[model samples]
Target: MRIAVAGGTGVVGRHVVAAVERAGHEAVVLSRGRGVDVATGSGLDAALEGVDAVVDTLNVTSLREKVATEFFTTTSRHLVAAGVRAGVGHHVLLSIVGIDRASGYGYYRAKLAQEEVVRAGDLPWSVVRATQFHEFPGQVLGQVPGPVGIMPRMRCRPVAAAEVGTYLAEVAAGPARGQAPEIAGPREEQMADMARRLLRARGRRRWVLPVDFPGAGAAFRGGALLPDGEGPRGSVTFDEWLSASQA
Candidate 1:
């Protein structure tokens, strides 16, 4: 099978690429580094040539709803259009679990928009919603940009990005299931506690504060972010990921 991974060089995308290749399939990377720009449809058709499946793991760091929505929708439309032209069979999207429930958040709303675009497209598509990555705490801290980190108090089941990537690869290679079972970690955890543990693992001396934010934050605190139904759970725990990462 020839698998093309959009945003193939990104955090989770990289793992998808690796897993695809490891599965004895040809992995074509659709990323800027490979001269395939998904956002504008540049070099995408050529890169997608002879591709059987396309796995989109592209990401945008913006917190603004408009910005994130535009990016996801535009890229998705382009990918679908090109996939139709290239005779690509399956279109796979990596999405966040419970984003629909937390639509109050700008980024989550953007993701919801992206999922809608993918679902409405002509090409056969599959949406794989996964929980927060183990590295999410670091990402949260990076957004704060301060000596003290302020993270939301939320219930989470953070999974390893690599596990999600591998799972996405498996899904992309098979027949399209409109919505695959949501994936999460083995154990439930608190977001703020995870952040503090992450900092402690890094041997950093900083105060990590947990706040009850408004809107989406409240939803998160209320368990809207955790996976609701039974689904695939990753093996790695936050503590294990943290310890190995720091080691």
Candidate 2:
């Protein structure tokens, strides 16, 4: 199978590319580094020329609804249009679990918009909603700059990016199923604890201050970000990820 991975240079996208190659499939990476911009539709048609399926892991670093929504919607439409032109069969999207349940968070709204675009498109598609990655705490830490890191009090079942990548590759190899079972970690964890543990593992002495994020994102504190009961689970734990990162 020839699979094209949008944003294949990203954190999870890299693993998806490796997973596809390990399964004896051709992995074509679509990214700015590869001279393919899904947002502007530049080089997309050529990159997706022989693609059998397309796995979109594209992302933007924006917390504003307008900015995030525009990015996801535009990129999704571009990918679907180009995929259709290339005769791509399946379109797999990596989305967040509980996006529909969450309100006030712009990022989740953007993801929902992206999903809607994919579903409304003509191509056969699959939506794989995965919980936050184990490395999410580190990402959060990077966003805040100070001696004390402000960690949001939220509930999440964080999974490993590699595991999610493997699942995405498997999905891309098969027929589109519309919506796949959500993927999450083995156990639910608090976002603050994850941040503290991540800092400890990194040998950083900064204090983590747990605070409630204002506005619609505060819904995350009430388990709006958690996966449902029947979703698939990843084996790697937060502790395991921290230990590996330290080593």
Candidate 3:
């Protein structure tokens, strides 16, 4: 199979690329870094040429609602249009679980918009919604902090990004199922506690204070963003991810 991975160089996209190649499929990485700008439809046709399926894991590093939505919706539309033109059979997209339930958050709102566009696109598609990755706690700990490093109390079921990537690759190679079952980690965990543990693993003495954030924060705290009981759970624990980060 000749597969194209949009955003193939990104955080999770890289793992998808590797997994596709490992499965003896030809993987073409499509990204701005690879000369294909997904947001504007630049250089996309050439990338989709001779491609059988497209696995879209594209992402933008932004918290603003408009910017995130613009990036995703535009990119998704462009990818679907190009896929239809090139006769791409299956369009595989990686999305966040509970996006419909938590669209108040800017990022989740953008993701939901993107999913909607893909679902209504001309190509046959499969969308896989995965829970937050174990890496998210660490990413948050590094980004959101005061002098004392505070985090908000919330519930999360974090899967390994690599496992999500693997699931996406498997789905990309299989039949289009419209929307696949949501995927998540094996267990649920508290957000602040996970943040503190991440800090401790890094040998940092900063205190992780938990607070309530309005809007998006409240949604997170309300468990509006966690996956439900229908999906396959990944085996890796948060502690395992932490330990590996230390290595």
Best by lDDT: 1
With a 3 Å backbone cut-off (N, CA, C), the pairs that clash in candidate 3 are none
Would you list the C-alpha lDDT of every candidate in the order shown? 0.92, 0.91, 0.87
Better of 2 and 3 by lDDT: 2
Residue 6 of model 2: what lDDT? 94
Q: Could you tally the backbone clashes for each prediction?
A: 0, 0, 0
Candidate 3: worst-modelled 10 consecutive residues by lDDT: 144-153
Report the lDDT of model 1 for residue 237: 94
* Higher-lDDT candidate of 1 and 2: 1
- Candidate 3 segments exceeding 4 Å error: none
TM-score of each: 0.98, 0.97, 0.95
lDDT of 2 by residue, 125-183 (tens): 99999999998889989998889998888899999999999999999999899999888
User: Tens digits of per-residue lDDT for model 3 on 1-247?
Assistant: 9999998987789999999999999999998888998888999999999999999998877878899999999999999999999999999999988878766677787898899999999999999999888877666766766657766677889899889888898999998989899989988899888887887887788777887654567777889768765778899999998898799
Candidate 2 Cα misplacement greater than 4 A, ranges? none
The number of the candidate with the highest TM-score is: 1
Q: What is the C-alpha RMSD of each candidate to the true structure, in Å?
A: 0.9, 1.1, 1.5
